[model samples]
Each structure stands twice: as structure tokens, then as C-alpha cells.
Target: LTFNIGERPTFRRFSTPLNQKNLTPFSRHRDDTLNDEIQSIRSLLDRASSGGDRDRASALDRAEKKLRAAQGTRKSYKMETRLVPDPRQKQMFENKLKRLSEQLSQCANDMKALRGNQQRGELFVGARGDQTNVRGEMSGDEAGNMMINEMNDIQDKTKSSIMNTKNMVSASKQVGEATMEELLRQREQIRNIDDEVMRVDDNLNRADKLIQKLWQADGHGQVHTVLRVRQHAAARGRHHLHRDDEE
Candidate 1:
């Protein structure tokens, strides 16, 4: 007796294929359905993991391990698609990589040049003449002397620069102080002018009151007329006198 491992028949109607070639569509559809199911399972697993469910996390970890194994197998598939040898394509890729490498090297060199530009100081030597040196004939003594000269030059330049900067700062501070003093003086002058104006206004008011009193004393008669005429004459005289002085 032989036992058969077979799928149970369902009540749903199904189409029977006439030929092997025609069966490809059905096979493809089945494969697509299986892929969709796998994707749904993975999505559910992801949600469960993110929700912090401990049981789901353990299940997800185990599922992920299996998936990672599958991904490793898929990596070979990717390599077969991308890295399998086609000489022309391979050469093109290599040339592209070479150009990128050259660009990277040039970028590195440019960075190095920029760094060199920013670096200060020079090599020199000191007076002590030691015989043993790295560059054979150019002994430690010569190197020390060169270094000493360089250091002296740098120090002299630095000192001069510092002095110049100090002078500039001092001059600026003096100018600022002078400007502030002048502004204070102008403010005082303005205050004095305001006081003078207030005094002049007070004097004018007093003069107006005195004139009104004098008019009242005159008693609306010939005395008032005489006083007005005299005032007009005096004003005219003052104007003419000022004109003569200008000439």
C-alpha cells in the first residue's frame, strides 16, 4: 500500500490547463500571492516589534534571523545581476571608479594645501654647533642656526605688529573720548540756550504787563496817542541805525 501526500479538493471551481506552457500564468499568480502573504507577515511582525510586545519581540527576533539568512542568499542574487562579468560593462565601471579615486586624491591634496597655507612658522637653527645631523652634511648646528634666524625674524615681525595694533587702539580710544566730551559740551550749550529762551519769554511777559499798566494810566486820551507815536518813531530810528552800521 502507498500513501499519497496530496491537497484536499475544495468546492470552488478551478480551470484545468490544456498544455504545460499555458500553466505558466497560473504558476506566476500563485507565486505572486505567496509573496504578498510574506510581505503582510513581515509588516505585522514589524508593527508588533515597534509596539514593544515582549512575545512579539521574541518572535520577531527569530523571524528576523531567518529573514537575514534569506537576505544573505539574495545578496548572491544581487551580485549575479550586477557583478557577473561582462567585459565592456566591467571596464566602464572600473574607469568610473578610477575617476572617482582621482577626484578623491585631488580633493585630499587641495585640503593639504589649504592646511599648509594656514600654518605659520619657519625652520631655522641655533648657535650651538652639534655635529650629528639627519641630512648628513647639513648638521644639527646648521639646522639650529637656521631655526634661530627664523624665530628671530618671526619675533621682530610679531613685536612690530603688536606695537602698531596697540597704537591704533589707543588712538581710537582717544578719538572716542574726545567725541564724547564734545557731545557733553554741546548738550550743556543746548541746556543754556533753553534757559536763556525761558528767561527771554519771562522778560517779554513782564514787559507786556508794564505796557498794559502804562496804557491804563494814560486814561484812553491824548497821552496814549503820544506814547504810541513815540514808540513807532523809536523803532524806525533803531532800524535805520542798524542799517548804517551794516554799511
Candidate 2:
């Protein structure tokens, strides 16, 4: 098998040795062993087929079909390798990054607008209170004086409330800006991760396609070999099969 990250490919070989001591769940016969191996491979391909990774799934499906056909022929083959991204894919990724950048800019503008509105509201409240207080001092009876004092206190409290409100708004604006910046940063990080994931997915798809081509070129003779080896190993110790690759 060959695995690649970016431009470099690492080739690795796998082999299974057969032993006579243990009978596998399929059967003792070579054909049965081959069937079991094919089934296992099919299961892996099935899982890889069903998910968010369309390219990977398609590649796996192609490999499975090729392997199945090879099983009918009972021969050995080699898979072909292809480079991923195919130009159009690279363009799509670039476009997505550009869109994300635009969204981040829009988010910054919205935060600024919110802060401006908050500032304006505080100023309006402050000016209203000041007008009321100035009007209160002009009337002069004793009751009016008391009323004026009360009005003065109210005006002072109103002024203090307006100042507090302005402070709160300023603090909120700072917090909002910080939050927006953080979110933008996080979004960019996610975009970068997605880009990496897309590249990895492309590589995996290419690997899968290569493996399929190899299986088709050879035939299914490798199935018996792998199963026979697995059975032989199971005799020495209990071997667990992976239900899902996540394990």
C-alpha cells in the first residue's frame, strides 16, 4: 500500500502467512478463505462508502467492485495511482477561503454598527436629562423649590444612570469586538483544518483508487493468502476484527 501526504508517497507491504492448525469461521478450504477475505474487504469498503467523504467513498466502491471481479478470476494485479485536487478542486477551495474572509469582514462591520448605536442611545439619554434639570430651577415658590430640589436629584441620578449606561455600552462594545475577533480567528482556524482535511481526503481517495486498480490487475488470489494467515494467527491467539476503522 502507498500513502501520501502532500507530495510524498510512502510504500508499505503487508503479508499474511497460512497455518494448518486453525479452521476459520468461513471454512478450511482455500475458496472459503478467499470468500471471507473478500467479505472483510467489502465491509471496509462499505463503511468508507457511506459518509461525508464522497470522493473516498466512491474510490472505496470502485476498489470493492474490482476486488469482487478479481475474486472470480483468481489472479494477482496492481493498482494505478493518480494525483488529487485535479485543478478544479483547488479552485473551489480557494473560493471557499475567499468567502469566509468576506464573512469575517461583515461580522466586524456589524459589531462596529452595534457599538455606534449603543453610544448614540447613551448620548441622547444624557442630553434629555440635562434639559429637564435646567428647566426645573426656573420656578420659585417654596413648593416649587422642593419640587426643584427633587427634580435636581432626579436629574443627578439620571445623569449618573446615563454615564453608567455609557460605560456599560463601552464595555459591551469592547467585549463584542474581542468576541468577534476571537470568532473570526476560530473560523479561520476551522477553514484551515477543513483545507487540510480536504487534502487528506483527496489523498485517501487516490490511494483507494490505486488499490482497486491493483486488485483488478492481479485478481483475487491475495484473499486466500490473507484469510489463511488470519486463521493461522487466530490459532495462536484470539484476534479481534475491527468493526469500524475508528477503533
Alpha-carbon TM-score of each model against the true structure: 0.35, 0.29
Q: Write the per-residue lDDT of candidate 2 for residues 84-179, one digit (tens) a residue.
A: 123563354344334433533443344344335334433444454645533222222433454566688899999999999999999999999999
For each candidate in the order shown, give its overall lDDT on alpha carbons: 0.50, 0.47
Please list the residue runs of candidate 2 whose C-alpha ends up more than 4 Å from where it truly belongs after superposition: 1-147, 215-247
lDDT computed for candidate 2 = 0.47
lDDT of 1: 0.50
User: Model 2 residue 153 lDDT?
Assistant: 89
- Each model's total of backbone clashes: 10, 7
Q: Candidate 1 regions off by >4 Å?
A: 1-137, 220-247
Per-residue lDDT, model 2, residue 97, is 35
Q: How far is candidate 2 from the true structure (C-alpha RMSD, Å)?
A: 56.1
